[model samples]
Target: MGSSTGTARHSFRRRFTIVVALVAAVAVACLLPRWWCGRDADQWYRGDPATVRGLAEEMVAFEDDDDRWRAGGGADRVVGMWGLLAHQMTALGLAQVSLEHPEWRDRYAPVVTRAAVKSLLPQLRSEFTSSWHGRDGLAELDSPDGHAYLSYPALALGMARLVDPAFPPHLAAQHDALIRAFERRLLASPTGLLDTFPGEAYPTDVAAVAAAIAVHGRATGTDHTAVIAHWAQQVRAVQIDRDTGLVIQRMGGDGRAHDAPRASGTGLAAYFAGFADRALAEELAAGLFDQQRNLLGFSAIDEYGDGHSGAGDMDSGPLILGISMSATGFALAPARAFGHREKFTRLYRTTDLFGLPLRSGDRTRFATGGVIGNALLLAFLTSGPELAR
Candidate 1:
């Protein structure tokens, strides 16, 4: 009996050893590419407009067919709306890159404007309702918490104005109507900050919508200072992370902070805050970097770097030992905008390693990300003072 028990123990030990070795091997495999990409991505990556536009054209080809984007939902509820919006945001980013490359104007400009001029919102609303809110779906635009979907149309119009000076008169009218709808939803919020869902809100959505508002104002020479001021004050009083000064992730309808500060949410808000308010954005970005990122094998953010752990959700993808894949990827935008070049490069390296880049002829994109990953990358790579300027 003793010999039999000893043999069983030996078998268990061998299995455990193999498991640990496999885990270590996988970690090394992932990090090795990141190390290489960090040192060598310059071969394919650059800050130039034409270079970025090349990626945009690829994204356009991969994402759009017959002037329509693919549907954006699956088992993951958050992926649906976020994935849907990514195409538009990619279009918006493509337009931003076009600012420096007039030759590429004909490729992405008309496409973005067409989606805005047409009606993608109703489809987005319907999908968002079914995927997230279930079969009942959202009944009214104001009632549901998704005003940020308007951001793409707002930004597309903004970009159209910058690239194509002849920006269609009818499209301009459509832009005005969209702004009114946004204003109506903004007014519908019980709190000054916009709601992302009924009775629940995230400051990221507010910042994004505020950015669209700023962009629209720039495009049309409209002043929305008063609304912005009030909204900022409201966010400060209720949603700003006291320790980090970044926007808090989740809040109740009564304007009470719900979750701890999270990088995935705070990072995106800081990225957009550049358009609405730059100084505050700088502070938020700096604080978020100091707070969340752990620079071990590669720079990665924690789901809640403040003594919390939970299962991976939509916002915070696959959390492993507190590290978030989503936060690490999405965190790039604010890192770049805040001038954290080292941190930004680290995050980008991580993205490059995980993103699975695919190239066809002169164009390249990360196939694993589909449009969602590419759009986020496009936004990050193109991010700077240029959008706000």
Candidate 2:
């Protein structure tokens, strides 16, 4: 009996050791390839626009429902809309790039614009008009918490305007109303920076306000210069991390700074560049854009650099740690449009590829995912801003 008991104990120990070894081996195997492939920054820029365009189209085609559009199969969500809109706009920008590389433009622009109008636009408008009470003069959107869920729609609206000029007229009244809603519900005193909402505020959503403000400035060409400037100053005072050039993800209405820099917040650097110091935008871009890896590896900061933290709310989609293509793409594209050439070039060289070889529906899906990627490439293709003589 004693011998039998000893033998059983030894068997259990052996099994446990084997299990541990297998687990460790599997983990290393999974991580080793990524580590090996991740080192080459050049791998990021597989700059074939035709391939990129095809990916964008695939993303749009994969949308089984008007409401649901994620890169991988997922439910219809806000980020999908934002991602689609940004993707279409990037394609329009890429048209100029396709001018030189005519092969890319002929394949992408027609389909991209078509997708924008037929699919992306309608969903965005519905979200604005129906889901949110923006059209009903109900300043704040009707969400569970009673906020308009401003950032995502605001960014989408801004992008849509670029895609279709008529979009602004259709939504103008609502647009102005949304702005006023922001003022009444989300604006905080002293700083004048808007919050996610009046009481329950997200510190970083103020950047969304900044984005809306910048869009208004560009779209209307008036009434926004001073307002945007003031908001940018107020936002910078409360949220910017001077040392790292990152911004706090959120702050209390009472004006205390939190310590996390969201991709959305950092991404705004390029959009907000025109209103604030150009150098600051450069700093923010540098701190935020990690060009060292591919899609799964290129995310921006989640709250507190939490390894597995994500933007799962209305503001973002499933986040893979260490890279945020969505955020970095948004930042780089706008930076390019606004004439931050050096930053644009760096981002372009580092992150200029999308789903290639046609594994999916349309290449614009990759374009949508890599909106900044297209934007950077487009900027390279377009004429540069003239320097002071």
Candidate 3:
């Protein structure tokens, strides 16, 4: 009996060892590609496909903080604007990720769809609709500080349609209204330098207006190409820094440029520029890419060392001593699309190895800073030709 028991124990030990080895092999297989596809992670960065794939994963995982449904109460609950934006973006990114890496599609599709509903669908149908209160039409969902808050949602609606044709029509209609509202706010001026507030004005608003119009054009097929062209010209006139070919942030109503070129503005501009003017877009985006150092710092100038220190804004998400990976992701996608191949590849490869925050089962999330904006960045990175193109 003792001999029999010893033999059984030996057999169990052998089985356990085999299982351990198999598990280790699987883990290595899963993680090896990511390491191999790592981006440069220094200054003047470029991007690569493998690295881009990893970035997509990073963007994909960036939606974890938006899991506030339980915290917000339940199904009909909502996380504020920022959180809402992230979830929408995450969903869009996941859907796009599904298309690119079909191996992961089945796993991500439903999750992305849910994330979208959690983020945008409810808001569009319920809160931001014409039926919303304010005693009828006295106070509509106006632009925030002249920035088209509707642009992201409009982009989300358009993306939803792209991902799933069966997406609701009301969402599309809401998107259309949002675009019209943007036109009313920004396009009122011939230069298209949008006012942040309805009556308040600024030259930097041109870039914002241009961006919103471009997104609206892309999303709804509204043929805003001419409108976008006008705004693009205005954006160039206002945001372009002649000294370094970098795009500046925050210009005044009197057409004066802000202190310096910011990562957020340059990154955001790159997207519309890629679609409208690749050459100029590349020039502007090139200033943001850092190839040799594997780092994409926040500002083109004045952000070196401890010069600029701060975080938590609607534009720049949680700057780390000034290295804004979130802004880097924003700039990288458009830069790649606009033929900044070297810069694109460097950004892609270097950003791959790090910045993924969580992994639940096969699902992952980046969740670096803001609850919502990160999700939108993920969506923007994942969806459309950003990764595919």
Candidate 4:
């Protein structure tokens, strides 16, 4: 009986050893890719010419393929919205690069123009209309009734015009019309808040409207100071959350919060507001920075502030242990723009680990990120205060 007990103990020990070895092998397998991907985090945050140029080459190829718009994989409305965002971000990134490196302007101009044009296509608007329950945001531009979401395409067009002074005349006129429409609606509104759809107002979208108007002013020398100032003052008084200093995510048409103050909205709002009002942008950036979380030399942003908790929505992407993908991704823009190099580097490591980027001869694209994801990363990584300059 004693010999049998000894044999049982030996069997248990062998099983435990095998389990330990398996666990160690799995850990190394997981960490190896993360370590390899993070090696260039600093270079990405610094906007290395080789890295930026390689991504640009990939974006140019993406724009050349007409079917790329449908690659997002969802309902038709989701596809359209994602496609529009992808094209808008692509155009903005290319335009900013052209402005920063004039030597490359000629090479990128055509792609930028194509992206801006595609952003305003009728099919995209049709999808938005369906999703908005027949709101037809592109219609009634002269009316003060809502539809502030149209500013997205307008912003893209303004960026395109800045890069290519000889933009198509018809599109240039459309861009001007959108700026004037937004100016009229904003000045006429009592609350300085405009609905993106009927009864649905988002401060982030309003911020984009303000940015589009500001960019139009930059590109065409139009004066939009008073309207922009009025919107800023209104946001300062009502939309900002006193506890966290982050902008409330959504509001009613009467300027009351419909949702809690959150990082995803605040981060993107900070980026859009930078073009119109630097002070306001800085304030939002400060609030967003307070919510940063660092673990093992990697960084992410919390979707909710202290004393707040909620589930992830379509905008926040997903919440993994309270770290929001969208919030972390969008925060990179403000981090780069505001000169937070260490923060940017750490956050980028997180992006690279999950992004699964694949590089080839003078070209790189994130394997897990389709066209929209790649376009957004391009925009966020290349963003800086110099883009406004």
Per-prediction TM-score to the true structure, in the order listed: 0.78, 0.53, 0.62, 0.87
lDDT of 1: 0.66
Cα lDDT of model 3 by residue, 160-205, tens digit: 5545546567756665676676666555555455544333343333
Model 2 Cα lDDT, one tens digit per residue, 152-235: 455435434433434536565566556555544444356544434434345445545555555554556545555555655765
How many clashes does the backbone of model 2 have? Answer: 26
* Highest lDDT scorer: 4
Q: If ranked by lDDT, best first, what sequence of candidates would result? A: 4, 1, 3, 2
| Residue 359 lDDT (model 4) | 90
Write candidate 4's Cα lDDT for 295-367 as tens digits: 7668889989878888899788889987887888888888888888888877888898888889989889988
The best candidate by TM-score is 4
Candidate 3 CA-lDDT value: 0.51
Q: Give the winner by TM-score: 1 or 2.
A: 1
- Model 4 CA deviation exceeding 4 Å by range: 1-35, 67-78, 131-135
RMSD of each: 8.7, 11.1, 12.1, 5.5
Candidate 1 residue-wise lDDT, 346-376, digit = tens? 7777777778776777787887877677777
Better of 1 and 4 by lDDT: 4
